[model samples]
Target: MSKVVLITGGSSGIGKSIGEFLTYKGYDVYGTSRTPERYTDSKFRLVALDVADTTSIKKAIQTVVEGSGRVDVLINNAGAGITGPIEEIPDVEIKRNFETNLFGPINVIKAVLPQMRLQNSGLIINITSIAGYMGLPYRGIYSASKGALELITEAFRMEIKDFNIRMTNLAPGDFATNIAAGRYHAPVTKGSPYETKYGSVLKNIDEDVDNGNDPALVANAVFKIINTPYPKIHYKVGAFLQKFSVVLKRILPDKTYEKMLMKHYKL
Candidate 1:
């Protein structure tokens, strides 16, 4: 049977590329995007879904269930990026960020897990980022959400192993995608602490993303891992510099790691 895969945030960026690549590889790909206008593929089915909305999430699954007999893979890729100092960012924006990036996946996971448990098979791929593991300036809230997701994935990985349901976190450094275009770059709010200390943080993050890896590269990695016999819990896909962040985090001491981050970001 051709594998049935469901990818959230599949209209653009890494999600869309993964859907396209997997469809070409013969999997029946069903991807969900907030906007119906984001993707079009004869080989893959695109569903309208808003990860932050419970109704949208449930309805997306309903659509997928009705269209496809069964789902084999679920990719939680819908997330938002906001750049600014934590203190400067409004409380509401922080909540909104986590709502879309963290709870969004949790809801999808909750809805899909029962079916996957019953089937005793399924692959859940989270398109997390280096932010999940490292702290970056100007993206404090984004990092917090991804970090929380990493913890959640760790717990799920252990609990679901026996069920034959795999959850893998894909931490890519920077990928060339529509994400940059979608990012919310609030001004260095008038007379804020961050104005003098981190005015360039947003610009830096955006620039790096603009010059990063192609979305297709990440999609290829996702395809390979989904097919691996013994899939690992985390797959690091990014440039050499990005991959080094893992090593630095592990081998370097706390202060050293902090310094390295500052140097890398030119803080």
Candidate 2:
């Protein structure tokens, strides 16, 4: 029997790409979306799900299990983006970021863990971002949420490894996607202290995203991770510079790394 794979936020962007890719690769792929009707991709089945809601997550996973017998892989790819100065971002928006990017994945993992444990074999891949490790200039909350998720994935890996289960953090640097268009920009008025800086930085961030690498590359990375017998705990996908930045952050001094990031963003 083919391996059953479940992907969250599979309606569009990277999630959709991965779902389609895995489906074509012969895996029994099921994708979750807030409005399943909106996803017309015939390559994969769609399930109505809201990762932010525990009830929806549980129901969605249960549906997949009922239909497929088991989920061999669960890709926590559903996420949202927010950009703005850390201080000016509203509390609600920060909470929203964490809910979607961090808590959402956590809930999904929780719902699926029991089944994975029972089966004694499974793979959990969380779609984190390069910013998760190196904080972005204006996208502080996004970075923080992903960073938290990365940490969570690492901890979870330790706890679950004994069950013959595996977890990996797939950190993509940037990819051309609707994420930039959908990102929430913190409120910045004309007279606000951060208006000029925020505008400049936000513009630069958008440009980078617009010129980002193909989403298919990320899908390819996901494919490799699933097929590998023992995948690395963390995989960074994208340009050499972006992946190197993550490495440099670890080896370089704090202030030196800070300077490099600021230079990249023209801050």
Candidate 3:
């Protein structure tokens, strides 16, 4: 039987690519998005969803469950970028980022776990980012949210491993996606502070992302992982050059890692 997959933030970018790729692989993929009309995939269904809204997330999951007998894979691909100095960003903005990038995944995982436990065979892929492993300038909140997601994935995987429920955290380094130019409205007035410190870092981030890995590449990676016998705990995909960055994260101490990041990001 073909697998049934649920993908969040599947309207565009990496999520959309994953949905399409999975469809080709014969999965009845259901994607969640606020703009469902734009996502017209005959092989995949698009349902209205706002990850920030728990009720909406629950309803979407319920709808998918109703349509399909089971959801075999849950791809937590719904996330956005909110970049600015930590101090400069407003508390409300931070909360919003966490709601979308962190709690959103948690909500989806919670909604799906019961059924998955009963099935005893399922895959949960969290679309975390390289940011989950390291902190970058001007992306404090975004990084913090993803960092939390990494830990959450770890704990959840441990809890569900006995049931053959696989939880994989796929962290892409710099995938070409709309997240670099995320549509976040600034809640604060004229620059309060942190402009000078974060300006260059943000510029570099924008530039690198603008010319980063294609979304389809990560989509292919996602497809490949689902077929793996023992899904890896962590999968890091990035441009060839970013290999050194991951290596730096592995060998260097925390403080030294920061310096290496500064050098790579040109901060």
Candidate 4:
């Protein structure tokens, strides 16, 4: 039988691309959405799921496992983006982003572990962000949430190794997607201290997303990871410079790297 794969937030964007590509590769693919009815044209099956809700996460996993008899791979791709001056962004919004990006993925993984252990084999891929590797100016909250997930994946790998299960974090750079439309933006308040700089940074951020590489790149990476016998703990998929930025951080002094980011963001 073909491998059964479940992808949260797979109705669109990178998740949709991964789901469609795997389907074409002959995998049994199921994608999740808060409103599955909205994606009538999805190439793979879409099940109702809201990552923030534990009840919904359980229901969605049960739906996929009951239908496919097993879940060989799970891509935790459901996440929300938030951008703004850290002080200006509402506390509620920050928590909400974490709920979707970090806590939600954790709960989903928890829901699937029992089944994965019962099967004695499984793979879980958490779709993180290149931004997760560092603190970006207006996107700090997004960075922290995804970065936390990255570290958690590191810890999870060791804990689940005995169960014949695998977990990895795939951090993608800006991809041409509707993520900008969905992201929460703290309003650029009139005469506020951060108004001018935040406004300019926000504009640049949107343009970057608009000009980003195709989502198919991320999908291809996901496919490769699934087929690997022993996948690495972390994988990054993006433009050369974006991926290189992570390496630069590792080799460069903290202040120097911070300076480079400040210059790049024109701060």
Top candidate (TM-score) = 4
> CA lDDT of 235 in candidate 3?
88
Q: lDDT winner among the candidates?
A: 4
Clashing pairs in 4: none
In candidate 2, the residue pairs with backbone N, CA or C atoms under 3 Å apart (3 or more residues apart, or in different chains) clash, namely: none
Candidate 3 residues 1-267, lDDT tens each? 898999998888889889988888888999989879875653478999988787898888889889988889999999988887676677888888898999889998988888888887899999998877767677777888998998999898999999889998998888777875564634333565655546666667778888888888888999898899789788888886575576778888899888867776666
lDDT tens digits, residue span 1-267, model 1: 888899998877888888889999999889887877644543478888888788988888878878876778998888888888776678888899999889999999988887788788998988788887877777878888988888899898888889899898888889888787887676776677667657666667778889988888888998898888667878888999788888889889999999978887677
**Candidate 4 segments whose C-alpha is farther than 4 A from its true place:** none
Please list the residue runs of candidate 3 whose C-alpha ends up more than 4 Å from where it truly belongs after superposition: 38-43, 183-193
Model 1 off-target regions past 4 Å?
37-43
- lDDT per residue (tens digit) for residues 1-267 in model 4: 999999999988899999999999999999999999998999999999998899999999999989999999999999998999999999999999999999999999999999999999999999999999999999999999999999999999999999999999999999999999999999999999999999999999999999999999999999999999999999999899999999999999999999999999899
Candidate 1 Cα deviation (angstroms), residue 214: 1.0
Question: How high is the lDDT of residue 184 in model 2?
Answer: 90
lDDT (Cα, 0-100) at 3 in candidate 1: 86
Ranking by lDDT: 4, 2, 1, 3
Estimate the TM-score of every prediction.
Answer: 0.94, 0.98, 0.92, 0.99
Clashing pairs in 3: none
